[model samples]
Target: MNGGAVLLPYRSNRPWLSGRDRKRIAQVLVLVLLVLVAAAVPQGPAWAGANLIANPGLERVDVGGFPVCWEKSGWGDQSFTFGLTGPGHTGANAMQITLATSPNGDRKAMMLENPSCAPNVTPGHQYDLSVWYTTTTANTVMTMFRHDVAQGWVYWTDLATLAVTPAWTQKTVRTPQVPADTDQIAWGVTIYGVGTLKTDDYAMEDVTAPATGTACSAGDACVKGVWQVLPFNSPVRGLHTVVLKNGNVLLVAGSGNDPDAFAAGTFTTAVYQPTTGTFINVPTPADLFCAGHVQLPDGRVLIMGGNKAYPAADGSHGYEGLKDSYVFDPATNSYSRVNDMTAGSWYPSATVLGNGDVISLGGLGEDSSGTVATQYFSQAQQRWLGLGEAHQTWNFWGLYPSMILMQDGRLFYTGSHVFGNGLPGTGSSIYDYDANTITPVSGLQNKDQRDQSMSVLLPPAQDQKVITMGGGNIDSNPDANRLTDVIDLKQANPTYTAGPLLPTGTLTGGIPQTTHQGKMYVSAVLLPDGKVFETGGGLHNRADPVYEASMYDPATNTFTAGMAVDPVPRTYHSSAFLLPDGRVMAVGDNPGNGSFDMRLSVYSPPYLFKGARPQILGLSSAEWAYGSTRVVTVDGPILKAELIRPEAVTHSSDPNQRFVDLPMSVSGNTIGLNLTSNPNIAPPGWYMLFVVGTNGVPSVAQWVHVG
Candidate 1:
């Protein structure tokens, strides 16, 4: 075997090793190497032939429900990507998806075309389908279909039917079966419905598989079952504020009156995954008001300033706030000191900036009375940098100064005041972060937007809308009292002609008017579908309606009747991530302890539609044989046409003709078409021909046959 020569025994009777034998051996070795390389590759968009289809090399029929995924680590799209761009559209702001029927009633789902996936899927082996989805009717069913050549029509051959839930859910579907004797595949999705399907995004990518599925199971058990809440024994006596991080929930609440001492505790924050639900104590350096807490992107929480318990003889402990900060890390299950703020304050507002830092607004500083001093934390510096002085000082209270970041990178601060010494008096100014300036804009809306209220940006449509929920004046000013006004902030944009008020109302009639100091109050969360959930505000009930929750749908611009769910009346609590699975965890917030109330609860959104739920039609077992025949007939007007193949095509006659629908549109254009074969679908000799037409009337059908 020296110098790459064959070392075989010298057998005079054997025929000489021919060139053909060497070529065959080489071919086998190359194939073995290819398989070895493929197996070593991680599953996802990065892998070759990592098309939307699963088992790409094997040429299997993926069918719907086979679990198409985008590796979580990939930078770009893996399956499919859609850009809804044209004249007048604001790039691609938000998207929704629905399964509906064409005017003639044919099943259809939305599709996104990616130039990258097209090369991998043209005329053959794998295809992609995806949507930006939200639900209005809870039980709406969305399905995926394929063009079957065997029968000369489109059918639900590879179905991925999804049920419409109140919140938005993103879906991806792929078909792996490829036709033999071809190198091209055509693909499209349709939502079978009569009503319009609203979607903000549509995409497709050449991906291997997702790292993990975001949901588990079906029905209410799927959403409601993933969470469990750990209740406080003393019930966070006067629970006031709540925040979530990692899988742990943190609360800065008060308990046991006297000097009105505040306490703290922890729960869970793991989003949609099933959590063990444990309750732990958050040790405070001193007994004080746990005014506000914000989570840093690196997972550390900045526990802000608050007043101490028992008026410190000279009224210092009871009235003054503490700037001593603590950072709680779930990784180690412990709290450590982080750098403290420049000023000791209470009733401060903290907003997470786009760069991952937090900008803390003013509140009552060391004087025990409120002051408008502003400071922001620079993660790099691990210290707070003063943002000069607030527009107003000692004017804003430590409660209900709303801070919400818009997608455009602007921090909108709506309510603060201008008392004689910078303590909260009464003012409504809109601040611009880029310029670090505040300009007062007044239709004189909710001056009481301070405590026991919440605000969220409606999924920024091209239109750009923002909503402000409940707040009241706690007798500070006679005109400012407990309110329930749904103010539309969209009208007050930097540049905007007055659009309609998009529906408006208040929660006045049936709720009560308690002491109104209104600590530990919360507002609502924006659902993927443009609806919002208003939860954990003050005790506003006909028969003590405090611990109640309701939903506000932007489509109709109205709030639903409230439901009792909060274990205790929560104010100053926090809820993040309306999980695609439809469950929201609310942590922090005590009854009014001004501190010690550390409690946690889970708020699940309502099911929008009710009926027999549609199941995720799993992948079918049938495979299409290659070199099979397909015959397509046009019964109506020609319009445009397209031919969709099951997977990528390797070789075939006129692969372009596969997309037959795009070119054939006339008053009565009828054509008979032939689909050839490809090696990708070896063993099998057929392909699924999916088609869509818009001859004036829309038509979608598929057929399966030999080419």
Candidate 2:
């Protein structure tokens, strides 16, 4: 109708349209308008979600010269200054915080505590929180606080530990399900060290709905796997975790990084039975914290060296190592004293040789200097070798070095270690115990920054390849690197070559992330499927927990990203190992804040959710010699078999851990597995023998002794 005029019929005094006709016309016009609006708007689920944060750009400031709806918060005795800065991630302003002397505390710029500024959240829903930032410090965490209706604003869990970003970079993390009675949340980036931090463009969106269908799928659990945080907490701090032959987990917490505990002699140990979900406390004999441990041929755990004394509070003296050693008999759940080492050792590397003896190397001595004496443990005599018998290389291998046992009986140090600048030479070397010589290996990138990095012997053991992944320097306080280096010891001149980068989580603004913001304290567990499940780590020395994980397939030398992430922050002292049921269990996290997280989380690989798991009906024998053939009776057809050496992991180093592939010839439900002839490949120890079905599912492991 032009000019809003209603036309009338020629013979009628009434309007041109009837009542019903007018109504139909109005409906048609409404439909057309809606179609136009829909066309102008974005389509699909992309338009459904939105950022819930208010004053996210930090452009609006109050009279106090701080970002409106955000506040400066911190604790402990620290000197800091907070204000607004220019050239924000998106707007003209960003928040800035400087810590001049953060000896005991931390600082952050967080959302205001009031209801109007906080982001409203639905209980049980997850939100993706992201922020753009630049920081001179390596220690930062995405801290959160929740509004509890009755208790006002209360502290929530920290989401992710952010990497050091000298340049403008986006850090994103997904929160766990909102706890009940929580109506809103506030978050901020925290700087816990002496440095400067600038942050802007904060975003929080409800990702619960979309994640329900995509983050993890009921149909795709076999590919994505699933992580579940257990309901109960571990009784011990779990600084050291060993998968016992009886299928129980031995948790050792000697002193547990607690100076007060060391003073009080409150060392602790516990045996956790996964099947029953029960714990049996064991009386610890010494302060076994920072000790070296490995499984003996008879299945006893040899624990050596630990904190003999704590460092002085005023820095006059450093931590002293202990020469005391003990053997834990799982059968009795007790520790028995053994002969002391030649020198005190803290954070030593223990490797079990093919002959069943152990070589203990590296670590700080009683004087707090690197111990140069290479100690030997004679399994037959059950005593440490005397000084005359000990090999004195006079070389410090650094703390908790990843000393892998090669086929030729030489030890290969992967250059992956914890704390301090890397040693002289190439940062990696081959040590011949008999000749008392150390030959440096080359091509380990950024070796000094490899503190708490992980080194894994890629399965099958016959391949003789090791991969070192992600590390940072805690003492120097540098940004962690996402460098993966692989070395083929089988080569004539074995050297490290760059491997795939560690997978990272999502970023904000569709910004292209060129490299993986690497992390330290990463735990790599070898799964029955022949893939390594790499989980939990931190960015700084032991502070910012990195939330990245993946499945590394050795067969293809590639990483399958997008695996389920463990919700718990696994940083310093965290450990992960494969369980007998084919799942992976992660435990322990001691952040720099002096807090210990006893929470334990278990990850069930995608193979578990695929089809029916293969069953081991019977076995010809429980003992197999090298090169022997054993018959395994299964309930269904099996495609392959493997013998995985049980894990005795601590400080992310387990040189004794390896997977020996058992070549199998299957006929119906009967399978004949040919064990490896090489003792160095299989080692002399108890192993978890697993049979895989044609459907890719593995059976509950059966315990077998290999010698």
Candidate 3:
């Protein structure tokens, strides 16, 4: 076919052509038509995936002159204007939002609040969200909302904080798994400060797919784990979270960081049953808001010191502590009064001795000054010891100092504190209570900035090693540091040595930060798998929630970075503890804006999603004594066994929580686990016993009393 002319059949016209010629001419014409069509069609980016957003380019508008499938949304007292701007990143129109005066709240241009406009999401699947924006404010964050079948539309989480960009920039972030029962989701970029923000294209794509096959592998839920936001919020602010011996969680608020509640004497406490997902309110006798708590030998919680008074509004005075003490019997779910301490304590550190006595130190006294007296709670008498009975240290330790018990009955201060500049001297010391002496241990890096740092007793407690990681001086510093320090207390003179730098991960700013990006208020949970699961923290005091998580293998002394991140801002006043089911429960986040997040989230580790968890068939005895070996029957061969102390955590200062490895020899389904000879290694109290199968999956813990 020449000059786009069709080939005619052999007939009375031009020259006759063969059948092969006609077929070849027809094929040539078809190829030419395809070329024209291909040239006329538009081409997309090579890496473009299926975008789940509707009206992604803002090219379509509704009758009100607003972008279709989108609406202007905000809260608090903010004067703002929202409309279609010009020169979008991909189209002719872009959404523009301006804040004239934002004294409180925030504003955002988000997807419409209807089912037709919101993007549908699958439970337990993560999505990558991106948006092109240019903003004048540094206080912008990516926000999202989910539609729940039972609860309707609710705020999900602040995905990430966005950095200031004068020029249009495309920021991409991965959201934690879409919570269960969530049918759809809406998201947008938010401006909490006075600024002008312009946005163009928006995109969201599911990145996590459902697992395939029976075997577990990388990139699957079985390897990366998953996080789920509980449908119901905690009735009380979980300022104090303790994993009780009965497998229920005791959540203590005691004024719950609310100045008004403190003024009204509205103390609160609740017992949460993880199995039933229910809460039973307990009558609180005193203001235990910043109190010291630990599990007694008999499984009762000994709570001491608390909020006597809130700080003065004009800075003339500060928070005052109370000397009242009480004990909560888990069986009765009631608190009974105990003898008052010698001095008031607002944020004391409670360490249960091997003999069952409790020593509480460091906290603001009633007068708002450092409390110098060391208060001792006598388990035998169930009261605070008289001044003459207990020796005084005559030293003022900082608030919430991590005072872990050493094997020799001395206490090791790991230089971790909260809400202050830290103590004087080296910030870490060994206190011999009987001798009334303090020996300073050196080599802790940035001791003053260790506030809200987490000090964890390395798993297999016989190792006698402690790791302090990630801290910042919330009172004076603007950034936290990714520092990990390990100390071998068994040394002649134990001193902290630099360990591996915390592995890098994406920060809340939707950027992959360097390893130098650290965090404060970090929760380091001791896992039954003999690893430390570090998650939930903030870059600043109570703002800039960081989105980094990892599993620290004590055996290798290395961190497996990029674990699943919790979708909540677990900042100051947050706490996390291991549940009996090999999961971690995280709660509470009192941010700088004076708001308390009561939502709770649970994280199931990779081991749980792994095939068939080991099962504990029976134990020779639930009560274990020092220097003893017990026989445990399991459904399958176990590679290891552990005894994890029940958690009595508050302000991330639970020196009581430790993982004690039980040396085991497996023969078929029966295992012999030799308990430690030293009571100091595994303190005399209730513990959760877990057995790990050869497949690395741990069984549901069984409550065992170790003495």
Best-fitting candidate, measured by TM-score? 3
TM-score attained by model 2: 0.68
Return the number of clashes found in candidate 2: 1
lDDT of 1 by residue, 601-671 (tens): 55544332221222212212223222122223554322222232221100000010011111111212233
Candidate 3, residues 1-707, lDDT tens digits: the string is 12112211211122465667656755664455334323322223212246778678887554346765678888888888889889888879999989989999888889865644677787756667889999898667777899988879877655555667888898666554455778788999888888999998998876553354446764556766889999999999999998999999999999998999988889999999999999999999888999999999989999999999899989877999999999889999999998899999999999999888999998999999999898998878888987788899778888999999998889999999888687888878899999999999998998888889999888867668899988998779768888989998988899999988776666666777765678889999999888899998878788888887899987568899878888887988999899999999999999888899989999999988667888898899999877566778999646568899989887878999899877543455776676765677777889999987656789999999987
- Please tell me which predicted candidate would have the highest lDDT against the true structure: 3
TM-score for each model: 0.46, 0.68, 0.69
The 10-residue segment with the lowest total lDDT in model 2: 1-10
Cα lDDT of candidate 2 equals: 0.81
Looking at model 3, residue 634 earns an lDDT score of 93
TM-score of 1: 0.46
Ranking according to lDDT, highest score first = 3, 2, 1
Give one digit per residue, the lDDT tens place, for model 2 in 60-156: 5543456656788899788888888888888799889898898787887898765446677877566667789998876676778899888788676
Clashes of each: 152, 1, 0
Task: Report the Cα RMSD per candidate.
Answer: 24.1, 25.1, 26.1
lDDT of each: 0.38, 0.81, 0.82
* 1 against 2, candidate with superior lDDT: 2
Screening candidate 2 with a backbone cut-off below 3 angstroms (N, C-alpha, C), the clashing residue pairs are 222-606
